[model samples]
Target chain A: MTVAIQLGIIVGYLLLALAIGLVAYRLTDRTAEDFYLASRTVGTIVLLFTTFATLLSAFTFFAGPNVAYEQGPEWVLVMGLMDGIIFAILWYVIGYKQWLLGRQYEYVTLGEMLGDRFASRRLRGLVAGVSLLWLFPYVMLQQVGAGTALQALTEGTVPYAVGAGLITAFMILYVVVAGFRGIAWTDTLQGAFMLVTTWIALVWVLAVVGGPSAASSALEAEAAHHLALGSDFYTVQWMLSTAITIGFGVAMFPQVNQRFFAAGSKKVLKRSFALWPLLCVLLFVPSFLLGAWARGLDVAIPEGENVLPVILAEYTPVWFAALVIAGAMAAMMSSSDSMLLSGSSYFTRDLYRPFVDTDLSARREDLLARIGVVGFATASFLASLWNPATLFELGDAAFSGFAQLALPVMVALYWRKTTRAGITAGILASQVFYLSSLFTSIVPSTYAGWTAGLVGMGLGLVVTVAVSLLTTPAPDERRAIYFDGLEAD
Target chain B: MSRPALWGWIAVAIGLSALTIPWFLWGDATLVAGVPLWLWWHVGWMGLASLVFWLFARRFWGLGIESDSDSSGGSPGSGSRVDAGGERR
Candidate 1:
């Protein structure tokens, strides 16, 4: 009976999400921007929540608590405190410039602006390709979260394969029916539910297992290491590198970049970012703490990502557990749908139209983008079947991949002297070094305490600067398109 | 310096320090509010970041005050007034 209630809530939530998509479809127009970016018409509240929901992926909802449950409360510093601030600054730095340039160029994708600025179509295609390589795994991370959650929630009755398939189908339907507008609305709804339920779960768990003071005392007595931050893994270097990689990686995410274009105005973007840290506080604090608290309550988390469901099922009531599970689903779906949408946009705009179908019309472009959404989601669904890695491991790999792009993209955006050759060389050097570390043993995963991704970013920056000085400059007209503003340092 | 530009640099300065400063050097034994001093220290910086970004947005980016008036027609290389500063006047 309890399982039935929980499954019913999840199905009902999915139906509600579908209904919102249908409504958004009715409101949507046939233009490319309308389909892809909500015609750049998102307002402040929706903008804020959608960005919030999208960034707070299943990694946070599931893996975060699991990390806390296994490692200690120190995960809070990595997941909550550092990321809140780091990502906020990144959004401020990256979003402001991207929004300004996006407005001026009517750019629907990051590649469009970067390519046009350098007058290099290959640069455009490379950016999209790099995004796809990293983003595919991240999308699979969401599928992995959903499947794991259902398998655990229903005690393996549903199975991971069924869970993955269900989410992919719903996400494809949502994006195809409503596009960007539907995504924004459903994200807002799901984002709110996620925040509220997370807090409720935290409070309920704390109350069930004794309050913070009692829980902390119990933790200290039984597992003192969980309360402290100087463990072998939580060293000064690892914490800082984790924060830096996740922070900068978040800024370069294509889905996040697209949000900058969708904002109705600078006010909407600014307001959203301004409140971002507080949002992080509300969500991450309770979520991670609950995971840590589970230790005091003697909850057995067989798998780290299963921490949320494990705790709620053992301690909380049936109906409340259902709501919290639904929220976790919301976190996964909200993130997954946006990623699918962004991936399709990248493929259609950067690769297909430019290379495959040079004369593709707006109508065909829209159709192709929708097809790309299904394709990307299907690929990720299959990828999730391997159950490749733990949620945190998958998220970390994806975050590191995107972080390497941050340096090149930042340099290209602000520095007019950044040539097409320079940016390309920087990205190539970064990816080669970074990938070599992950795949081979050419460089130790952590060399002299810095992560491979950080090393790649550092090398990429150096190579870009060196190559730009060596290469012929982009024409003055191309430079002016990106830099012709009244501000100077 | 423009109000926003000054705050922009300040934001970056604070941000770099928050990420770079060795908070983990603090001993894990000292707990504040049930969290280790090192963790609490980072939380303090998170609060500081929120304040810094709010200031940057209001004074530097001119968030609420600035609106994209020519959004529909402001394609780059065209004659629209939209520029990197994000101001029309």
Candidate 2:
């Protein structure tokens, strides 16, 4: 369990991932659809695993256990578990509808769908801009997680900067060369590896700690208060906040939307959605229980994160530790590639192709997307070197920022009376409120950002509806103007 | 909308979740992970609620349907099919 050996194992895994990426690149053609949507032919099984892998990122794998370790078996674990379930249900109820529309419209990005739905290029630009801004910090957090895991596993032998740099290089090279096909195929392999390793770690830990019953008894004896449910008021608020935050945010994320569009048919997409939740339950519950067991053992973890993985390495045997490290790395790399691809696609399709040059060919668009992938990966890697104050805080901020767009976007899509003027006003109002909440400590609670964002969203909807009703509807001749160039297929 | 079934399911989900939030199960047992068993019951209920919602929605809401025509760029016999390079032909 020396630092050198741990570093060696991590490096080997990175190389293996890169090799997988290169093979996928060879299989992928140099076309806009292939590069962006995997030629819209991804099957059910691949889609299911890729979706699962992308959703279960470093935050869930590494930071979730840390939360359980620190907070015991209190509301935090309940909140986290509830968030995952909510997201799965949201995907079925609402997210699948959007996927069907994505297929119908041949949409490769959320911005594309919005532009088509609203019939406004300006709205598309605004959506793309806000998405890029929200996703940057999320991508940066993944880089930080990879670097921190490397540093911990290697006992600081691999410095944060070097660790981040190595992973970034791999991500950039893989994404730039392979695109969506590369990310999806590698994600399938990595997702399987992580699932197996997680079970192995859980079983080994349970056996070593004298089984789940002993662990449960020990944890109960140590911190009886952390095990109880909060009052009805607290549970209701906790459930509502979690359900809204994750339910809305996951469905709206640009990367996930891209996956929805990539599936070949609505049937394939639906099947993937049906199968994904089972994998999530298997992946999430064990980690939460492990954290609970740690609490019972009275193990002291670091403050503000870097706690769970560190504890795993310290307590587990060398082989099991290596497997856990591999799983964490797999989660990090799988998510990072998808995020980088989505961010790059936003700039290439929505920002560059539409405004910068309308005559740009598909080939040129693909090239720009590849270049954007490299640039984004490099920037996030540098940010990771600075070292974040905390992982969960950064993640929560990103989630709240993206959740602000949910109401306006959904309203515009399903409600014909929603006006362009209203969407503009809503975007500006929500961004201002969200930014103010971030900079000023006006909100007293940790989730104040979400509350403020929701308030702004509500105001924006009112303004949009009022303005649309006041102004005359677009003329009948102009009705074709909105639907122009749009084919239902 | 003919999807009253969908609405009915959503109500059931909300009701079930509400029921689980009260700690009605852990009467005399001491707490497990620092909280009483009733709290664990609540979390369990939330998790169950999520599962039920997902299953019912997918089964009744057409949430899992995939239209191959959308990907192939044509209706069932319109002569469009994917080639080796993934282009519609």
Tens digits of per-residue lDDT, candidate 2, A128-225, equal 99998989989999988888777777768788888888888888888888788878887888888887877777777777777777777787678654
Docking quality class, candidate 1: acceptable
Residue-by-residue lDDT tens digits, candidate 1, A13-32: 98998999999999988767
DockQ of candidate 2 (2 decimals): 0.14
Chain A fold similarity by TM-score, each prediction: 0.97, 0.90
TM-score of 2: 0.85
TM-score of each: 0.91, 0.85
Chain B only, TM-score of each candidate: 0.46, 0.45
The prediction achieving the highest lDDT against the true structure is 1
Alpha-carbon lDDT of model 1 = 0.78
lDDT for each residue of candidate 2 in B14-36, tens digit (9 for 90 to 100): 56534643535422345554334
